[model samples]
Structure formats: structure tokens, C-alpha cells
Target: MFKKFLAIFTLTFSLINVALADQANPQVVMKTNLGDIKLELYPEKAPITVKNFLDYVDNGFYEGTIFHRTIAGFMIQGGGFTQDLERKEVRDPIKNESANGLSNLQGTISMARTNFPDSATSQFFINAVNNYNLDARGRRPGYAVFGKVTDGLDLVVRISRSPTAPKGGHRNVPQQAVIIEKIERLGSESKAN
Candidate 1:
């Protein structure tokens, strides 16, 4: 009788673990001139934002883009401009998912928007340092944080430390372009970290 109970407990525990693994967040890798950065997105917390980002990834929207904005000790922004500093027209703006309870901690990725709150389209930024002020506060809308860097965070920090200058009317543009070669979704088994 004791052996049977132990067997049942083991089977239940195995099933639970499988479910947990199956529910793991989807991951993507952005191959760049600087280096590859792997990120895991929390669709459960910000479904709309994640879907929008994944759609851009699947459509190859981020390929050949340049990191158009960078600030030391702040964040690196990209996914909207070509290597030539031309802005690519993006799809309709997405709803602000900032209230999703995710913080803008170091390495976390958030939507880059204008002052109007819900104006986020294709542009996104990775926090190079803890940005608690970017989190949603009460009634004010903040940037929607949908993911975080899982690997190559040091590359992000390095990119933040790059020198910047005004270009095409945009300030803090990296003097040497950091090109995004491509962004690809990783299969569940393909997650490197």
C-alpha cells in the first residue's frame, strides 16, 4: 500500500513539472553587430505587447535596423529605424500595457512611446540600469515592459556606454551604428538560456 502511494505521488509530481515547463515564457534572440541578446517575454503579463512584438519578429521587421538611441546608464532604444537612420513605417499603435505589474528593472525590455502613453509602435528599449521611475504609477501611464534579457546583458551595458551624437535630428544616436542583424523566435527546445 505504501509503495502504491509513493508511485502516485511521483507521477503527480512529474506531471506538474511537465506543465510548468510547457508554460515557460517564449524566447527570442536578436542577432546584432554588437552581439546576440536573448530575451524571454512574459505574454501572460502583457499579452497584447508580446503579440505585437512577436509579430514584428516573425515578419522580419527588426532586420537591418539600427539602435537609433542610446544613453549611458539609461537604456538602448531600437527596432524602428534603418541603418541609414530612416524610420520604417510601422503598424497601428498598441494599447499601453504598462499596468501589467512588470517593473522597468535593469535588463528589462519596454515599449518606447511618445508622451501620449499609447503611442508605442515598433520601437522598444532595454534598460541598462534599474529604472523604477518608468514603472506605472497610480493613474499615470508608463512604458509597457514585456520582457527581459536572459543573456548578453553585458552587451547591453556595453552598448549603453557607447559614445553618442546628434544624427537625423535624433539625439543620443550611437556614433557607430549598432546594427540589428535579425531577430528570430526560438523554439521551446532552442532556448539557449
Candidate 2:
């Protein structure tokens, strides 16, 4: 009887491990002119946002897009405009998943939006500091925090602190336009683990 129970426990553990491994581990390598930022996406927590971001990445929509908004000690916004100041029109807006319980912490990635909650459409921001004010359940429905910078956060910080000037009808755009050269998945082997 004890042997049977042990076998059952082992099987359950194996099943749990397999279940976890079967889930897609979406990772993004943001190749910026300043540096590259590696991020591990959380699809379980923010499925819609992750799907949308991955769709854009897969379609090569983020390449050459400039980091259009940069505010020292605030956040870096981008994934919309090109170095030539042309905007990439994105698909329909996504429903705000800010209530996903993710905090807008430093180095975290969140969807950018207007006053409306469902206005997040491709543009995203990287938090420069612990922005508790941007978390859901606040006065305003907060931005949808989806992922965190697993690597290259220093590069993100440096870009956030870069000098800026108004461009494309938006303020705080980097004078030279810090562009995202490319975005790619690291590898299947690395992601599988």
C-alpha cells in the first residue's frame, strides 16, 4: 500500500512538471541602438497582452520603431513610430488587463494607453522605477503590466535617461530617436527550459 501511494505521488509530480513544461515560455530580445533588453513574457497572467505583443514581434512590426517617449526617472515608451517619424498603425485595441495583479515595478513592461482602459494598441512602456501609482485598483484604471526585464535593465535605464525633444506630435522623444533595430526569440532550447 505504501509503495502504491509513493508511486501515485511520483506520478502526480511528474505530471505537474510536464504540464509546466508544456506551457509556452515566450521571451523577447529587444535589440535597441543603446543595448538589448531581454524579457520573459508572462502569458498565464496577461494572455491577451502577451499574445498581441508576440504577434507584433513575429510579424516584424517593432523593427526600426523609435523609442518615442523618454523621461528621466519615469519610463521609456515606444513600439509605434519609426526612425523616420512614421507611425506604424497597429491592429484594434486590446482590453486592459491591468487587473492581472502585476505591479508596475521598475524594469517591468506595461501597455501604454490614453485615458481609456481599452486603448492599449501596440505601444508599451518600460518602468524606470517602482510605480505603484500605475498599478490597477488605483484612482484610474492602470496600465497593463505584462512582463519584466529579465536582463539588460541597465540599458533600459540608460535609454530612459537619454536626452529628448518633441517629435511626431509627442513630447520627450529622443532627439536622435533611440530605435529598436530588431526583436527576436532567443531560441527554442533556451525557451523550453
Q: Against the hidden reference, what TM-scores do the models get?
A: 0.88, 0.84
Model 2 lDDT, full chain set: 0.87
Model 1: per-residue Cα lDDT over 44-114, one tens digit each: 99999999998898888999999999999999999999988999989999999999999999999999999
**Best-performing candidate as measured by TM-score:** 1
Point out where model 2 deviates above 4 Å. 1-24, 189-193
Q: Pairs clashing in candidate 1?
A: none
C-alpha positional error of residue 35 in candidate 2 after TM-score superposition, expressed in Å: 1.3
Per-residue lDDT value at 22 in model 2? 45
Which pairs of residues collide in model 2? none
Tell me how far the alpha carbon of residue 170 in candidate 2 is from the true structure, in angstroms, after superposition: 1.6
